[model samples]
Target: MNDIDAWVWWLVGAAALGIPLVVTAMPEFGMFAVGAVAAAIAASVGGGAVVQVLTFVIVSVALIAVVRPIAARHRTQRPQLATGVDALKGRQAVVLERVDGSGGRIKLAGEVWSARSLDTGHAYEVGQEVDVVEIEGATAIVM
Candidate 1:
């Protein structure tokens, strides 16, 4: 144990931290692994245990501070290039069959889809155009 280099220990710690980062797909663990790598660099430069530990802590904290807010901002960002299902909302579709609350079919996005009226009392006749209000499961709710 005494013969093992301090840098080797730091590298081992970095590898250990990397396992969770890969398994969990969490960015924080990767940050910690980066910190461990920094600590390994410090140890290679003859930094004592205290210096290595401080390097790890400071690097880890700095990375967390920077990455977390960017992650949060990314998470809060609005729709980017809506897909077919999301784009279906508020778009017009022609009723292929009598669409009531009980369920029917519609031609939406060049495809046939199961649909129902958003309002139970209202129904759209075949060939009538309706706006898709929402998609619930495999069904489109229209009005």
Candidate 2:
């Protein structure tokens, strides 16, 4: 084969191999999709017709087999759970007590939560409009 044809075949083989490696390593859509498309183009242009089709099918199956377990493992490790004051952001609440520079109390979502001011050294009155900035333990930092 000519140099150009040799280069094309090399690219095809590299992509067929590299795509699966990339999918195994990162498994993200952007990487996998690009790799798959590159491999398919290379195979179609530079490989025998039957080998190109077989390579595409085999590489795709292998990528899916390898990536599926990794995705499943990631999901299993961090199974979604709901808890804590994270569930309280954006909800309206009343300042139950004056917040000193240190801390105060607020009634939010029918629950009383310890609160601190993001604007440090500023005191909030017992009845002030506040937004929940974040939740720390049982305390909600307010703005």
Candidate 3:
């Protein structure tokens, strides 16, 4: 009980820091845990208490400074992958029936969908290619 080394204590501290990282899903704890491991390495190499403490502080602060901004940027960035109805917008469709402000049909994204013109008094003839301006609940508004 009296013979526990300083390096062993540092490793235990690292494990303690890791517990919160896993439970809270916060990355800062992981950075601190890495720092504690660095301190443990210093202690294993016969460094004094001051050297071990400095190793922990420097490593932890460096990791936080380098990684935090990158993580924040990724969190704030919008995903680029368009999906579902959003993907259908700005796509080309073939008019299967005469399309006007009233209504018609078009083959959009390999499926036949009810459609209408985006502009009134403008019409698309059958077999004409039109752009899908927007989708409105089972209907494609075309232009």
Candidate 4:
């Protein structure tokens, strides 16, 4: 172990940290891996153990403090795009069968879908147009 270079150890640490980043898909581990690389550079330049450890700690802490919040902000940002079943909401669907409180059918987005009236007392006749309010399982609630 005495013959092993300090830089080699640093490189090994970086590789070890990188494995978790890849396996878990966590950005924090990647930040630590980057810090290990910085430490490896310090070791290669003949930095003392104190300097190498300080370099790693400073780099890792700085990355955590700076990058984490930015990453979190981006991660929490919701896309405005609506797709799939969400697109069905508020859409106009044509009643294919008499739609009542119990059950009925409607042609939604050119697809046949089971539907129910939002108002139990309101029944729609065939060929009537209704607005989709929500989707529960395979059924679309219409108003």
Candidate 5:
């Protein structure tokens, strides 16, 4: 086919690759799409078919090699901030009522939470301090 037609086809391929990048949230597809755009530019400037193909491959591979690892590192380096009840674990609380093995109440994170002692034989009096061990349903296990 003519160079103009070939460049058009390359641009079409680039657009096709972009669809999957958007749908799947994959960065590799975006890299390939950019490579396809580069190849399209090469074809427009009178590059031979072999040169166009090589340009596409080199650009795609280089981007994948360089960008993918940086992206992965960024993904993994994000600080994992605990939320919800998971954040309550390991926090200090004050007993609002006598807490025994069965149940009681505690002031945790400014909220009153149903609490039980982590140790079956131990008990906490009102105004005692405790550490939350875990959250079980609507209750907190403390010690």
Candidate 6:
């Protein structure tokens, strides 16, 4: 083939490859449509018009079929959790010492942790069962 024919063929192949890559990488940029147009233009100018058109159609359809669902799924958001002490809420623990208005120790999920009671009026003795209502810095709020 001559240089012009080679350029046309190169354009055709580049469009075919670039279309899928752009669609997969940046679907929001609308590069797939641009690639499809380039492919069609290349097919008309280059030889093997029938084969080029068929290949372009097949690849464009395949890319659309594959990328749409993946893009939709990726746009979804996940729930967030509070950091630090708030993360330990709803945990069951056993008091290691008498927990009153002041600080004490507790065992939670096989790990010893510092604990305190929200109600200073109540007293919790050793081996008493409690639930972690909230977390405050390095301490657990127990009841």
Candidate whose lDDT is highest: 3
Per-residue C-alpha lDDT of model 6 across residues 24-138, encoded as one tens digit per residue: 7766334455445556565666646666566556666766778778878768844386664555689799999888778899998788889889898887999899999877777
- Deviating ranges (above 4 Å) for candidate 6: 1-27, 30-87
Q: What ranges in model 1 sit over 4 Å off?
A: 72-79, 96-98
Please, what are the lDDT tens digits per residue for candidate 4 over residues 1-143? 99999999999999999999999999999999999999999999999999999999999999999999999998899768889899889999999999999999999999999999999999999999999999999999999
lDDT of 5 by residue, 1-143 (tens): 55447789999999999999999999999999999999999999999999899999999999999999999998988468989998899999999999999999999999999999999899999999999999999999999
Q: Could you tell me which residue pairs clash in candidate 2?
A: none
TM-score of 3: 0.77
lDDT (CA) per prediction: 0.94, 0.69, 0.97, 0.96, 0.96, 0.72
After TM-score superposition, the amount by which residue 56's alpha carbon in candidate 1 deviates from its true location, in angstroms, is 0.6
- Where in model 2 is the C-alpha error above 4 Å? 1-84
> Which candidate number has the best TM-score?
5
lDDT of 1 at 27: 90
Residue pairs clashing in model 6 are 85-135
RMSD after CA superposition, every candidate: 2.8, 9.8, 2.8, 2.7, 2.6, 7.0
10 residues in a row with least lDDT, candidate 4 = 78-87
lDDT of 3 by residue, 1-143 (tens): 55998899999999999999999999999999999999999999999999999999999999999999999999999779999999999999999999999999999989999999999799999999999999999999999
3 versus 4: better lDDT goes to: 3
Better of 2 and 5 by TM-score: 5
Q: What digit string (tens of lDDT, one per residue) describes model 1 on residues 1-143? A: 99999999889999999999999999999999999999999999999999999999999999999998999899999778888678888889999999999999999989999999999999999999999999998899999
Error of 6 at 77 (Å): 5.4
Q: In angstroms, how far off is 109's CA in candidate 4?
A: 0.6
lDDT score at residue 45, model 4, on the 0-100 scale: 94
TM-score of each candidate structure, all chains considered together: 0.76, 0.47, 0.77, 0.77, 0.78, 0.45
